[model samples]
Target: MFRQMFEEKYMRFPGGRAKAATFSYDDGVKADKRLAEIFAKYGIKGTFNLNSLLFDCERWHGRMDEEQTFLTFYNRPHEIAMHGARHIFLNKVPLPEAMNEILQNRVYLENRFGRIVRGLAYAYNGYNAEVLAALPALGVAYGRTTEDTRTFALPEDFLRWNPTCHHTDPALFEIAEEFVKRDPAGEFKHREPLLFFVWGHSYEFDDADNWQVCEKLCARLAESEGIWYATCIEICDYVKAYRSLIFSADGERVYNPSAIPVWLELRGRIYELPPATTVQFAKEL
Candidate 1:
């Protein structure tokens, strides 16, 4: 039973033990472009959460039309999703106002980018159950929250495991290399090794300490062949796929994604997948 839950927690859509780590860049534009370029070089894909209002700020930033154009260009490989209109905290505002932020932004983004915005990252990761219920009506299949207590967040249901924005944690990043190479054996022993989710603003890649830590962690993730690097969207779909398959092969399933988190056994622990599955990390062009 524990193994079943463990496999369920880490299982991706289709069903497999593979771990994936996603690289997401929020706010949009040049930094978005740079992050895409870097990930592309490594054959990885990412999710770009955009705030529609800020696109107009290109002119204000002294770029004079460069902002929107730059974002339009970089948006090619990444999935362009809504990032709330004003970055407002949903808990503080009235429901209509908060829902409008998501609905309006999805409209503006579709008009500009021509893609259906299905995923969202709550500004500041603040939300209540009421907010979640409203998303489906607004055409959002899933959204992420600001939770990273573990390497990954499991679904309360298979339909949702959207880790909105993975907070940047320096502690893990600082020792990733040392931990992966040596610790995976003893100090870092877990039946199913982690698929680390480290995130931060792409523009801040210039920060000396932050950059080094991000670089170090990325290197470790790359070196560790067991884990899969994936974006939150990819994770959601994968989890959804996994659950649906278990319930039915045709992809019709009613279940939560977090019912499974990890499995511990005499061998210690390891990830488990359902009957059939392979979580893909590439993006649509």
Candidate 2:
């Protein structure tokens, strides 16, 4: 039974998908319309971080022309998260001001977007221990930073969620190629879940005049049978749900407490644990 359990213990994403890919774009801007269209065309999903205070201002850091366009562009199949109220550097600001920056933006986003704002990509990728310590009380489930790991792996700390790469990374295509070649069923196998998280500002594509970079990257990863394309919040929620699962003393049964369904692989077979339910596994020795 011990050996069987060891062999069966594997994590599978929704629909038995072997890998997950998510994108994060900071700063709501006019260029997001084109970027959104490209992502939608390729069936890719991502999270857009917006500064509520800068939504429609005519200033240098202004966002889209109108709030309605922003809403319509990312209403479904994507997420809208906070990027601070004024897009200030949290690490440099006083703790009270930093807290206000996050909470104010959260409230405005929740009211305007009509969804709970549970995630944030730090403005200017600025954060510190104090900021991390205060996030949970403000209802933030996860926070993304600009630090790139250049690898496909789940975050060790959601509060400081380091992304895999920036969209403009010179080796973007090479990384995508490496991600695509990781076949779960091949001899060279990885038992753990793989997550490819890319972050950047959509305006960069326009500034660089290299929209093809994103187009090609998306094309290389789009419609992959074994890959689950998700928004950043979706990825965080799914992983949280998976970790919330409770196991019986003998490992014969399990309970899921989260509202989201959890997937797991047992003895090379995938099992879905529906939300708020328990399931008994067949004994194997």
Candidate 3:
């Protein structure tokens, strides 16, 4: 029911349409040192997805440069989150194994970093419906996947069925359809998040051919309107804040944020949410 309603309300663009992009990386390797250095040099906040057990201060893949920066990365507070224990794909394994994989990594991080990590990215690019539905219970707020099907992703719970009715990245077939629709003979509308999410190995840059593609891609990703490069935790906060103002009703949906009554003040009379909620506080287009 919610998905149906979600599909109805947001199938069209809100207007001239707001835009955004999020760039992220996967697997913790020494290459990450250069990645972080480059991003930090440019003030671009790259989301570095990591596995808790991978950083061992030992050598692997030719270099003796295993990092102990798990302490630094997880503790930095900008962006990072769980990437499944041992980078295993939950969908490829049984439920208990999958859950344990995620949990072991999570606990490992918390124990080392002294704080909770509530985001995830399944390893091996594998995921199933059940793994998703179980996230809320496992202490994950959100996680990342490797799909780049060209769509602005909205969480399932927010759509009418979830609420936003945001369509999944229309992948191969949809891309073809969108191409036909846009020019009827031209190219796809690129109705996707302009901030295309791309990720893969750092060593890929080591190859002459692969490095050429990566060079052109990163060079062109610069956005003049400004791009807020962020990590997994930072992204989770934005999502939570955005969702706090959106809700669903019936098959039709409305953003009656102001209608939801709530106390205006929490602590020393500073924090508050007035009874008559309005879209005034919502993120602007």
| Candidate 1 residue lDDT tens string, 1-285 | 122321122333222333456765566655455566666656566777777665546433221133554455444766777778776787678889989999988998787776666878777777788887777889886776556544444565522344423435545654354334532323322433344455556756643335554455555666675455566666666555544533334322323333433221222233243234432221211
Q: Which candidate number maximizes TM-score?
A: 2
Location of the lowest summed lDDT over 10 successive residues in candidate 3: 158-167
Alpha-carbon lDDT, every model? 0.55, 0.83, 0.48
What is the TM-score of each predicted model, taking all chains together?
0.68, 0.92, 0.61
What is the Cα root-mean-square deviation between model 3 and the actual structure? 9.8
| Candidate 2 Cα outliers beyond 4 Å, as residue runs | 1-5, 57-62, 68-74, 185-189
Angstrom error of the Cα, residue 69, model 2: value is 4.9
- Of candidates 3 and 2, the better by lDDT: 2
Model 1 regions lying over 4 Å from their true place: 1-17, 56-75, 157-168, 174-194, 207-210, 247-285
Model 3 bad stretches (over 4 Å): 1-17, 56-67, 71-78, 151-195, 207-219, 246-285
Given candidate 3, what's the lDDT at residue 202? 55
lDDT of 2 at 124: 81
**TM-score, prediction 1:** 0.68
